[model samples]
Target chain A: MRFLSKALVITWKDALSEMRTKEVLSSVVVFALLVIVIFNFAFGASQEKMLLVAPGILWVTFTFAGMLSINRAFIPEKEQGCLEGLMVCPISREAIYIGKMLGSLLFMLIVEAIALPIFTFLFNLPVLSLQLVVVTVLATLGFVAVGTLFSALAVNTKAREMVLPILFLPIVVPLIISAVKASELALSRESWATLASWLGIMGAFDVIFLVVSFLVFAFVIEE
Target chain B: MGKSYLRNILSAVSFLLMAASLYMVFVYVPTEATMGIVQRIFYLMVPVAWLSLLSFLIVFIGSILYLRKKQSRWDVLARSSAEIGIIFTTLTLITGSLWARPVWGVWWTWEPRLTATLVLWFIYLAYFLARSLAAEEHRGATFAAVVGILGFVDVPIIGLATTLWRGIHPGALIFQGGLAPSMLLTLMVSLAAFTALYSLLLLQRISMKNDEIEIKRLLGLTAERHNTGDR
Candidate 1:
């Protein structure tokens, strides 16, 4: 119970920091919007084609923006030596991982929420469905879970900025592939069964990676 | 070490087996009616692919061993195996592309096998990058080991992706029933040769790594002594 409160407090602290500065969210939003605009201009944004491609475009933007956001996740902690202080705290390392992951997830979700409505308006697609939201949230969960771990790993490297993507893209291929596929299927009004398999894959990947990352985070963060 | 001598013998056997396999591929095995001479390249390409995957598995196992034991020797072994695996993987891609040129009429396609190999290459490249960028000596080994294990998790996925998707690569051998007697024999000989070759390369690379570490250690000790003497 005490651990839960500490986790929540850490999460809140991260959120509060982001809100006060708005640095991560602003950069992510601008980057995502730019990606959408580039895709619109490059692909001509036809309604028919947009419907087919929007899910992928949305996710790609989210992924790139998420990468940018996560690269900064540990920076503030490292810069201020707060991670060391946190490491010396009584809180469990697992709790710290959870807290950081949740913070990242929340930030990413906020960006997605903002992007989705703009995407719908620009592309003239319906974006208010609960199903779409659920898919987005689940996929984002998988992304953030893996991203947080990689973010921590990359932070310690000399080339943290370059190292994150190199470390991330290959490991997360399964998640990205299944997420994009499932999102596309869902958007197409396909039967639930069609999307179920991919969703199951995404869930399994999330669970496996989450557990593995939790177990390994202790070693990774060790001095 | 006894293992080094064993590897030496394995190297000799690999050379002999490869020579025999080449003979069998060109002389004994009849050309396929449809693909003609180009089909024979499969004999080389398939075995190399098999060896590459096997080497990657060895790398993963070596990494786990390194992590568990935290021995520098295991780290050396893992790094050596990965380097050899990359070489074999590169050969597999090249031979595959050459075979595809005449058959598929294109140098490359996003075929499952091809894509998988590309991904595998990137994963290992990342592994090398992770190792190279690590500042601490032991940290490099630990980071490489972790990446090594995690990267291999994609191998089966790639295998499955090839099958599930409309891939131009031939269906996997295991699922397509047994090979013909002549083909099976040729493949067996090739596999044996390549496996031996892999062991040889692994041993050579590991020895090199050990020597490099020893040099570094000696240098560090010398520097320490000079500092103490100056003091």
Candidate 2:
């Protein structure tokens, strides 16, 4: 019960900060939009080519924008030393990881939510379906689970800004590949059985990292 | 310190084993009926690729040990293993390219095996960069260890991805079908030799690291004694 309250409090704290600042969300959305426009110009062609490349473009934009928001998610806590205070609080370290992960996920989801319609309009694809939305959330959850842990790790390093992606992308490549493939399958209205294995792979990745990060968060958060 | 003698023997054995493996690869092993002489590269490529993945496991294991124990020796072992892994991975890529050039008509293709190998190379290179670019301390070691552990999680995925997603790479040796008895025996021998060589390299690196620490400790002691004498 206490842990739940602590998590809620931390989540609210993060959401309120973002609401006031609007720094992370705006940057991610704008960057994603810019990427979509650039991709459109670069790959200008008929509808078939657009359909083929659209998934790749959407994932790339989401990944880059996700990195931006994740990096910023911890900066304020780090700069003001609030992270130290939070660490001293009588909450589980896993709660802290979850709270931060949720904040980043919310920020990323907002960017995706906004970016999707824009992407649909710009690329002339139909709005994504319920199944696609669920897949995106699952995929994004996997990305954030790994990203959250890594961002916490990287935020302590000397080259915090540059280190996150270098540390992250390689580890998360499997997730991105599987997710993008699954997303493409979903978008194309392919049989779910064809993508069942990829979805399983993604789910397995998310569960493994989630547990691993939860176990290690205490060690990482210890100064 | 007495382990130096054992290490020397191990080094000699490693050299002899590598020479024997080379001889087997070139002389004893018959060339493939289809791919001709260039196919012989697989003799080197397979073992090196196997060792490369083995090194990742070593790194992962070493990292877990380091994280649990906070021992500097494990960090050194992990770092050295990762470095050696990179070397073997480079050889794998080069040899794979050599084989591809002859068979696949192009020097390179986005084939799953080739792409995965390239990604693995970049990942380890990033691991080294992450380690070296940080200050030489526990923080750096821990950070690198974490990345090492996480990075290794991709190895099996890459292996599986190549198999799952249809591409030009051959299916995994174990699962696709049974190999001929002679081929399997030869592969096992080569794998054993490579594993022995990898251990030899790791032991030598660990001993060298120990010597370095001892030398640093001796220097510190001498500096402290000299200051006291002067006072």
Candidate 3:
């Protein structure tokens, strides 16, 4: 309980700071919206054809925006040397990992929450469904679960920006594939039975990576 | 002395077995009826694929030991294994592609195993990039060890996801039926030969890395002594 609360405090601190600066959220939202517009022009498919590509475009937007948001998870601390301060705090390394992960997860979810409605409105697709939301959260959870760890790892490297996606994207290929499949089924209003396996994959990915990231993050963030 | 002897024996064994396997593949084993001449690449490809996977497992184990013991030797082992692993993985992908061109009618397909191998290739590249770009030596090793661990863990998940995604296609069985005894024997020989080659390369790389570290240490010592002399 105490650990959860402390982690929440870190998340709350991140939220408060973002709310103050309004940097990541605004940029991520605009970036996501622009991707939707550009992909629309790039594909230039008809309405029926649009449905076929929309799920991919949607996930790509989320992924890119999520990367943008998660990339900031550690860079600011690194630049400002707040990482040492965080490490010196009265918390386990695992708590710090959870805290950063939740912060990124929360930031990404908020971006998606804003982006998804705008996406549906622009494409004139009825993609606003509970199932889609569930898939989005599950997929996003897995994304940031691994992303936060890599974000920390990348922040320490010489090519900080270049390293994250290289290290991150391949690892999350399963999540992205599962998310795209699940979203396709969700958009098409498929039954739960059809969607279960993808959800399972996303769930398995989330669980496996979440535990692994939590364990390995200590090695990454150690000074 | 003992290590050099082991290396010499390994190289010799690898040379002899490779020669024998090459002969068996070219002359002894009957041409696979379906793949014909191109099937010969299979002898080289399968062993490399197996070695590639083995290399990462070695990396994974070495990384865990490095973290646990904090010994530079473990890190050296992991680094050498990863370097060798990347080469083997590249060979696997290239050979797989060459085999696929004639058999599958295209140089590439989104087939599950192919997709998995490609992703593994990407992961190996990422591991090397992470290592090479870290500014400090020990830090680079630690960062790479983390990558090594994460990359290995993610392989199965990537494989499963690609398999499920490609569930639309009937998975191609590598061989339609069990291998003939003669072909199996050839495969065993090739696998052994490749394993020997992989170990030989790993041993050579580890020694080279140890030498590099020793040189660096000596350089740092000389610089420190020069500074003291100036003071």
Clashes of each: 0, 0, 0
Each candidate's DockQ: 0.51, 0.52, 0.81
| Candidate 3 CAPRI assessment class | high
lDDT tens digits by residue: candidate 3, B21-73: 99999999999887788888989988998898999999999998998899999
Q: What would the per-residue lDDT of candidate 3 be over residues A58-167, giving only the tens digit for each residue?
A: 99999899889889998999899998999999988888889889999989988999999998898888789999999999999999999999999999998887778998
lDDT (0-100) at residue B66 of candidate 2? 91
- Per-residue lDDT of A73-128 in model 2, one digit per residue for the tens? 67668888888898888888889988888888888888889999888888777648
Angstrom error at residue B229, model 1: 5.7
Docking class of 1: medium
Q: Where does candidate 2 chain A have its weakest 10-residue lDDT segment?
A: A213-222
Poorly placed runs, candidate 3 (over 4 Å) = B168-177, B221-231
Top-scoring candidate (lDDT): 3
lDDT of 2 by residue, B18-102 (tens): 7877777777777767778886676677888988888888888988899899988888889888888999999989988888998
10 residues in a row with least lDDT, candidate 1 chain B: B161-170
